[model samples]
Target chain A: MTERSGTVVGPRPPTVIVDDLHVVYRVRGAGRTKEVKGGATAALARMISPRRLAGERRVHAVKGVGFVARRGETIGLIGSNGSGKSTLLRAIAGLLPAESGAVYSDGQPALLGVNAALMNDLSGERNVVLGCLAMGLSPREVRERYDEIVEFSGINDKGDFISLPMRAYSSGMAARLRFAIASAVNHDVLMIDEALATGDRAFRKRSEARIRELRAEAGTVFLVSHSLTSIRDTCARTLWLENGELVMDGPTDEVVRAYEDSAGRRSSAP
Target chain B: MSRDVIPRHGALDPEVGAAELAARYGLGVSGARPSPVEYTRRLWGRRHFIAAFARARGDGQYSRAHLGRLWQVMTPLLNAAVYYLIFGLLIGTRDGVPDFIPFLVTGVFVFAFTQSSVLSGVRAVSGNLGLVRALHFPRAVLPVALTLAQLRQMLVSMAVLVVIVLLAGQVPTWSWLLVVPVLLAQSVFNAGLALVAARLGSAVSDLAQLLPFVLRTWMYASGVMYSIGNLTADAPLPVRVLLDLNPAAVYIDLTRFALIDSFTAAQLPPYAWGVAVAWAFVLGVGGFGYFWQAEGRYGRD
Candidate 1:
């Protein structure tokens, strides 16, 4: 278990405290069953195997990672593809259960991930309304904010694409609308995992401004992006995870530089 | 707020640990499942979303068809026509019931509602992994919405059914109002079955493949194509009673008793409405409880 990494102590009370959180995924298919002594013995041993799921592989996606995010702080998560960055964001957002330890937060964290479309087959207009409703907005409130969501996404500036289903929208347009729907309401803890990576530079800048504004509005925000400059610019603190373990957690510059240096060392060594 | 001003690690001021600080801030475990009452409350808050989702999914399902929404009416009508030819004309299983065509069509329409609920229910949670993983609403919403979509489809079919009954020379009367209660009871029962099916299907991936065969067998046994009395007349009392008491059969019989003059109350079992209501309540509440137990585990691969 890691100790608390922040020295930004103040009356800015804690919003999210992830205490040695562990998340394991039980994936099926393409994993060898545990080997046993002999042929008949192995066959018989499978019947008596203590494992509840036979041949199911256990992927320890997030190891014991701990940190406390206080109010109004933007935390960036940077790591390799399989290094538990997304898993950590999801765990903090309460989408995945912790195999051990826990994530304590003041309120439910709203996670914005790239792959999870609100409703791919529905029109962008319908998706905005449904998204607002799904986030617990009243029907009246949805009506009120409907135009705001559409305008903020800017999908209609080119044409009348908002009336069309999201499946017809370019991926970037979909991502922009998804971000707009999620950011419409101020969540207590907002976690973003590469959700903004698809948009154009102008849209990205507009969203970064929105994220900055949200930092003062919400309890905390956690961002995970492969764009190192995005991480460097958006987040104040950064967490570096490798092979399901947190390799570093400190100021954004220090942690990102350390992660890059390690990658450089690995590439040069071979 | 001064941006990016946080200092180095191991600087928690020594006396205060992270957990202690979180405790002071009154933070609870974020990923913990809500208690049943709380879950119900949160589900209630999502009622608007559920209804909208149900309507959108139900309507858009047939959007790609050439005939558009007409297929909603046509699919079941065509099914009714097939059953009528096979049973009413070829097999002659009418068993002296008056208005046999109406009886058979009503059975097919009502049974199809339950069949659709069970079929979609099986895939409701697992199929919507995108929505399930992306957002946090009650997982029950998917099953409930699926059943509701089926319920809406049934209502459209019901309107056509009313025209069919009128054309068959059935005079309107107070008993016709019974269709409302029958539909309410059946919808609740269907939603309940959906919930139960969603839970089982979420864990057992093979259930989706196996459910149609099971449902088809259920349709045959529920007397959808013929009168139970004629089919089970030679069987023992208990076998007949079980067949009569079957939930699917009970729903179809209630709808028949209300609509067709020949399929009157004496033809039904003792306290038929009571049996129907009981089935609805049991499955509605019990299935919801069964699904709620695994609320947090729905989207796991």
Candidate 2:
């Protein structure tokens, strides 16, 4: 992959295509069932009753959502809790199975979530190596970028905590380290799920700059964050999902304004 | 909100197959399961990750222990000691067996190697859901890496076993070199079993709870502490033949025959080397293919 330093402004080829994708989560015992009355009698009743016990609940997390993501585009996914933003991102990254329809990507998408795969029992330095290797970097490349990665994360500046177990690091510190490791490579498609929400202003600034750099390298980025300010500052395009449906996909300012307006109305009315 | 502004020229028609759609749009299907050959190639590319993970796990096995890595060699030795007291001294099961201490130690160490690999394999996928969910690599790496870790542990314990054998007054002969090939065969067999266990354990997590009881029965049947010959000497011909063909017993017997002077060729099963190689080939290749077939389903509900 060629590394482009600054923003390359031009028409870019499409890198990710999601066409009428549907993702449903089958949660066991989530569906309603007839309640039994009292202790032993209820247990006996459940045993003999013709009514089916504890049906599977299908959570339609992503329903027929479709969009095209181009190289050099940084897209923001904004939604309320349980609105399928994370599910959509996961489906795009091919981590979650699509119930129907399809997701097409130009290259393997790298997903960096708050619950990333770093071992908490291992030291930060070890985690850096493991994380890099997990991302398909060779041993030599990991050694080459070891210092640069630690410097980018800035976890060592506070002290020598890089040698300490990751369990000792604060959540912000962990998230920053995860971001640093993930952004070190030039991914074809990069998805960030609320990793930036935990970091402070300076870390957030650095992370945003890194995202821009990844975009400039012709990488498609899908960022899911609850913070609208971050979305407005980082993404030119915003997708608003509500209850697993794509409510809007447009310029950041317009979609964010409309989403906030509706949210405001709903809260005021209630 | 206008769908018209965003071009849907290459959007799926819902009628065409995914491959056709990809061909039309020149897009790669995300989450597509790779062909078997392709999957193997991908796995081969991540060989470094496998080795690194195995080394880290092997080193970290005793990180928190008071005695540290001494325990790796000590745990099996202590087990051997207790077995020697019970089965060898008090029970007098060692009457017929020559150099019973070396015999028992070899059996215990070799059997424990496969036992621990299978046990660790049971949790390989379920325990590493964090890695499986966050990263995009072949799931086979988890089980294979785990087997490698157990193999390293077994190697350390085997080094100690060599010293014990030498102390037992057994001279190193040309046949002793056969121990290398025996271990290589056992590693292949254990890796295959690990793959099978990883798949089953991931599908039904209850397998983890039930595995110990099953393995305990297996350990008893494999004759880890005693010679199966003494128990089966009076049995029917077919029963004796079946016991001889038992894969675990076959491996343990091979190692014993290689390392112990008292273990003779007549005591081993007919065509011992042939049986060992066949078991390794069947289990190693077959188990891997079976596990690979379920590659896409791992870590997903």
Candidate 3:
């Protein structure tokens, strides 16, 4: 596969080509489910006559966003809540279908999101083993990396938390374990959605190093984060999304500056 | 997301064919379902993961109970005891049927496999949306693992089955070994039902709520407490044949013949093995095809 072009030796080659992508979430019983609009009257209207009011509502989550991600590129996605950041990541991961366009990629993209847990009833150790195995790692490989994964997640630092079932874990600890498991191997395109925000400073530094190592191995990484400091520290490029559209795609400093300025303007206008 | 990432510019021309460009770089369309052959291969590669996951879930299933793992053997035994009270003693389902306790226990244990398989299969995909969306492994693994977990429970139940028959004064013979093949055939049937249920449940999650009642009705129709042959003796030939051929009924009847000397001594139903194996083949292969048809659609929005 790598012999396809002369750029095999070159570090940067196009790995993902997402052209004119559109994602509309067709939610059923939409009178109350995941409504972007949240208020008292909306709630009242939904509760009054759900059957008559609830229909398949199309949530235009990602609209006409196009980008090409190559090997060795770490792209940061910056958007306010409800701005389709998670939806876009999910679309790239192939968990959601494209409503209009397409996402072309060389291999499977692993999307690690806050809402995705492996198994809550299993122990943290089992999750690591299962998560690695699910990603197609051999048992020997999983065993070799088992201790490193636990130490990286740091869940067992304060106590023997690895043996405890995941249901007993705090949300932060769960997220940390998920991150550690996902980062164990180098995925062609690894997308992290708000999952990295739960770790402490030491863990954050370790994960940032892991991201850089993945990039060095010619893997593409996409990170969606509210932490501007994280974006500035880890990603060289950033995409700004607002209301399900890609408003800006450029250097991290440029896009973050533009995003902050627009937020300031919106706040000052009222 | 191809690792041989090419575009240094990272820009797509509005007019240039993006599909052609991606294909030229050996990229595949994301979210496209794999071909049937490829799907099988991928599923086969994860066989160990499937087994490990099944064992984990089976061990954890009864962790909440005070007696813990002991409940695995006790819960179904208790259910059998209750059925014996209501159906065996009160209603006298044991009439004209030899060794009523062993008979009822066998029916309960055998049908329990299919019952739990269907129940867990209904939730296999819909319940594990997090794992489904988060990982790229075959979604079929969930249902298969759930069936395996039920099979683990049934294995313990079957052990208790042998002891119960011995206590009921039914001497164990070489034919008792037939339970292994019978259980294997029933497992295939149960796995197939689970696959079918997983597909339906993934589409309409409310199927999980409706399935228990449906399974209960099926259990009654399959004659877990009474002898189908005795009850349907006076019925029409067509109805008798049809009732005897019910997959669950055939499996339970086969198990009875294997364990009880009277059942083997009595005139056995014609072609019971033929019909039982046929059900296994049809559901096992057909259910897999049906579930595989919707491979890419699971856990999607």
Candidate 4:
């Protein structure tokens, strides 16, 4: 196997290229209902489990999905629940396994999700440093950017409490700090999943501007959200996924209009 | 943020099946366009990330403590004294065992490290589910970092153990140097076990709760508190061999012999160390192989 040389990403590079991706989840059968003798029950259950007999069935999460995110591209993934949007984002971020497909990336990718909580036992401020290291940033870089991360988070006077531990802060405060740490650096490929949904309007405005700054620096961002307004306001390109397949991929206005019309018709019909 | 790390190149080469490389290296089985060398290179390249994570986790626990990091030293000290009192003074194993305090302390302390590594390792990746879901880096880093941190604590405790040995009037010998390689082997073995446990711990978190109990049982079986050879001599051949299969035994026995300056001649055969090393290597590499096979799926809830 020949080593691939590391290269710097730029505006012309394809930051993310996914082809023929198919993702499936397999879960083990639990709590046997089959009646049997005590010792024999376990043995019989194991033998009868689908995982042992014919292999666990795969629940298709994303099927035959293909797309590319070039440098300077801000793509919004819009879909309803169970539409495979999150799974597609996870596959692209390299978090979820695909049954048969390929996702190539120009550089390291970071997935930012709403559930990505900092170590709450550690103060809000310390989480900033922890988050930076988790993102693969060097100590020197963390030191260089520490002040800016705190400033961007806008939770200054919390001081020693910021240094105290995360569990002390409210959920909103923790989210704000985590968001600051994650967005502190402009990444080559950044994927966001509904993280912007919880923060107050002012913080959301701040986050949108920060994302714009990231795009201006020739970075590619993938945002997965149910909010058409956020996607419309931020992304240049919009992707519509339904039932584990790509339904549409085009400019934001075109896709959003189609989605809104369909949604409106469904609501009115009932 | 470091532009230097990003590759300036074409999209992944088409000739190779990048999906195969990904599956082989614990990347996502599907849509894995990672190059053939990406696995090894990624690990090598992220050396800094490993170090940073280790240091951060090591320090993270202490940052909030009122006693600060002193607990690192104090906790092991307490364990040693408690065991010395129970196994040394009260039970009176001191008369039967040479360098009773030394042997018992080293065995107990080292066992603690191994236990910590394995117990924490089973939960290592799962405990960091948040980070795993959000970041793209080597999944092995979590278990490896935790094992290294625990190893660091063992080293410090070893130093304290050495002082206790000298103070008790036991003469140190050249065999003391042998303890280093033996301990390294044990460290490797512990690390491997941790990786396996971490992977298993995810799907069944109940296993994580059960692990420490298992380790505690293993400690007794491995002769941390009692002499297994003496206790199992009358047992059947298979049972004795089962005791032998307890990997921690070889390590704890070797350390005890080293401190008393008697292992090479009167105790376990020379080849036993070699067998232990081989076991460590097999388990270390084999456990990693098993864990890595489930790499991309580890982050799934």
Candidate 5:
């Protein structure tokens, strides 16, 4: 790391630094166009008009949130539906462009989304190879770890399903396979977005243990999940977001408690 | 939980830009465009992935068909049959040209290679949004891999073409060796066109709907069914030069000269090889650079 002036010293060197990051989605054709009266003249007027037939809407998914994550740290993101948790993770993983501010990572962050695009037409065995290769693992490395990947995914526990096309597997099986392929590599930073929510309890426990091992090996893990129990079990720190704003960032128990209390109050009041 | 611990909120000093903060912490900005050289190097490192993707896609194309992989060869053969029946027998495109069957087959197969590649390239990024959004690799890989898959299909089709030519009284000659280089140059050219189409298709989806018409017009003008010489003979010198220099026409002409007994060096344009090589270089390298400029923007909404 090159030394730069005006650096803020922390308790430990930061592996990921998000500085006032904002993410906005410009959704085209989101708003309805005004109806034009039915007539040839009105149709001609509509055609010649400069106004667009459909309008655009801007979704401010994340707004000026900042944080620093150090190596060997696991951070959980807890937010209500449509609260920008997934967007923030995607921004950190370089999957989405930031509308303002920036996210800096010490190494390439691998994101394991719930819908990881392993080809359904391909067999489970083939998708594992493809997924590993897409992650930049050499063919030889994938071949060497092939058996372990299959076992970790546990897709073949029922039978010879590994040889079957991925379309045959249930969503849970596919998500587990995605998680297995993603975790096969010791990524510098791993952002998992609700991948654990699909798996059974046993698989979730295994995945949580694997995440701890990854953290021990000096990798940063960011988990976004609706399941607060999983967050409490895995992350020592948590960030609470509501309506694209960070409401709290502190010890996992405190943040989770605060989030749950607010949610309870809102639900009861309604 | 410790009550005394205070959660940091936007704690970094506001004086420093994100770049300096990243540099000081050995971090790279997310979504930053890599240097061209670095991007190319990373692409090179993923060559295995590209090959695997190509092979899988190539094989997957026919998995649902009863004939399985046999469709690879049958597609071009069926196309050649339709053209042969329509243009060869009915319309009499074979009147002046000797060995018209081989010539027609060669032109159809060659042109179809580029056409299918470019057509597939249009959907390469837009169709594979799932993969693009889920993973982080060079987005160009999708286009390149799609082209490679088409190239493989073309190779299989070429085998059937060789047999048809052999049966149609076209004997092997020293010039037949030229087919290899001709195919190589055409593949490079198609790959380049595919890259351009991928970017354009992702940006403007209307290209997909408009592409078949465009390609059909291009094919008719490329002298696929007849000699380009006949079309340009009475035109002005500038028009003649342009027709002779057309890349697709040059490629088809090269293959005809290599395969058909009637197509000779005299019928070829001046410096045909030079024109073919120049098109390949210009389009291949140029399209790659153009596509790389949009690397950070492919899967975004």
Candidate 6:
């Protein structure tokens, strides 16, 4: 685990070096006997009935995706549903392992997605604390920024309800709180997965402003969204993905314009 | 804190891709640092984050039930009472056991910690898959947080057990101080299990579904209610070793030594504490190491 040079070499540089990242899911049947039986039959039947093949069917979510994220510039991953945008994000965040590639992050990268909500059973106020802690803020940091988080969410008027479980809050309210908790802290790199979708207009304005601040503070940000407007507004560059492939990568406006033009042409042609 | 004294290391590096640029500016290894030691040091430096999360999880977990935080005391008390009624009074199984109520109650409380650990911990990672993907902190912290949360509840239950003991005519002895070290040992043991469970739990979520059944079988085997002496000599050697492997047994025997059963020092194996501590360390340090090795991987769907 040490270097031969004896200069205390560190982990390989982490400019998000992802080379040929592949994710495959295998669906298996119950019981060893059944699984074994199914596997043998599936293997034998592959030639005749490839689509209906039973046992150990693999779904490749991401296929041989590679990229490098340097410091400063935001990368927008634009893709259709199931296009491997989220998979690529998760892989880079180290949430998912690269089947054949490597993700060398300089340090831990923060990922933001709607699924990462504070416990719905706890009040928004408590959720703010939980979210902050989950985001790697110290207790002292949380205590100091406690009010700022609440105020940013603009749900202070909700009062004692803030102490109520998140189940009581509306979708917009929860989104705002989630954003407030997440954006309150700056990460070395932050990945946002369509978190901006549920926020109201005012909250979107605030959240966008916060994202700008994060970018200005020398953090690398990855925004994955279907909303071209959001990506165009926030990101300098955009990555377009289709069927688990990086279809395009360039300036946000140029990529978005091309993507829109292509989709419009297809619709009109049909 | 005003404006990040340290230079940036990620894609934000102004002199992009220049190794000397990051090194000269002292940016803390940027993306090229190869030493796992420094990598771990950076991860461990987030200790305060772990504590904050533990508190939030403990408070959030307790706030769910109708009785809210009171269930912390009531849950173990209820388990103890049920076992005391069934094993102590109904079965009349503690014929040779000295302090039946205290003995059974302490065993119930101590074992409850371990039981919840394996049971709740089996899903600790998978259950928080969402958070695992979004946040970047030590994944071991999740399991450790769960252990601490459960410990808070267990401590409340222990307090209630102590009151019940006092009411039942048991007097505190000078040896009560030993309980502190014993409890600490038991906690470390549980934390170790938590670490291993978190990794295993994430790998196979089915372990979570199977935990309750497994814990039930383990409970009877480990002597949660009756004394281990009650098992007949004819019982297989493997069964006896299995009993010995039970950290719960060591905890129960230690608690008994502290509270009631002092005469049979030979019956209480000296190696039990050592085994428990060793297991705790092996599992704790080993589990954390294993978890950290896959630190950036937990977020993968």
RMSD of each: 5.7, 5.9, 3.5, 8.3, 5.8, 7.6
lDDT of 5 at B186: 88
Q: Report the C-alpha lDDT of model 6 over B182-216, residue by residue, as the tens digit.
A: 87877877887887787778877688888888888
Query: lDDT score of model 2?
Result: 0.82
Q: Per-residue lDDT tens digits of candidate 1, residues B1-301? A: 2222323342343346556666766888886778989999999999999899899888788866888899999999999999999999998987577799899899999999999999999999888887787777888989998999999999999999999999999988889899999899999999999999999999999999999999999999998888887777699999988898898898898899899887878778667789889999999999999999998788766
Chain A TM per candidate, in order of listing? 0.87, 0.86, 0.89, 0.83, 0.87, 0.82
DockQ per candidate, 2 decimals: 0.40, 0.34, 0.53, 0.21, 0.41, 0.24
Each candidate's TM vs. the true structure? 0.92, 0.90, 0.94, 0.79, 0.92, 0.83
> What is residue A4's positional error in candidate 1, in angstroms?
22
- Tens digits of per-residue lDDT, candidate 4, B1-301, equal 3222323322234443444423323333332334435655666666676775666677777877899778888888899899888988798766656666777887888788889998779879878887777666667778888888888878888888899889878787787898898889998998898889888997787898777778878887878877776677699988977777667878888787777663344456345678789979998888878777776677774
lDDT of each: 0.84, 0.82, 0.86, 0.73, 0.83, 0.69
Better of 2 and 4 by lDDT: 2
Clashes, model 6: 22
**What ranges in model 4 sit over 4 Å off?**
A1-14, A18-21, A27-59, A100-104, A123-126, A157-161, B1-38, B62-70, B77-95, B171-178, B203-206, B232-246, B261-264
Indicate whether candidate 1 or candidate 2 has the larger DockQ: 1
Q: Write the per-residue lDDT of candidate 1 for residues A208-262, one digit (tens) a residue.
A: 9989989988558889899999998899998898867888889999999999999
DockQ of 5: 0.41
Count residue pairs with overlapping backbones in model 4.
17
lDDT of 5 by residue, B1-301 (tens): 1111213432555566556757766798877789889998988888999999999999888887999898998899899899989999999978888888888998999999999999999998988876887777888888899899998998888888889889988888999889899889988898899999999998887899999999999998888888778667789999888888889989999988888777899988889999999999998998889889888888776
Candidate 4 accuracy as lDDT: 0.73
Clashing pairs in 3: A13-B5, A13-B6, A14-B5, A14-B6, A14-B7, A106-B1
Report i-RMS for every model: 5.7, 6.0, 4.6, 8.8, 5.1, 9.5
Comparing 1 and 6 by lDDT, which wins? 1
Stretches of candidate 6 off by over 4 Å are: A1-20, A25-56, A157-161, B1-44, B233-242, B261-267
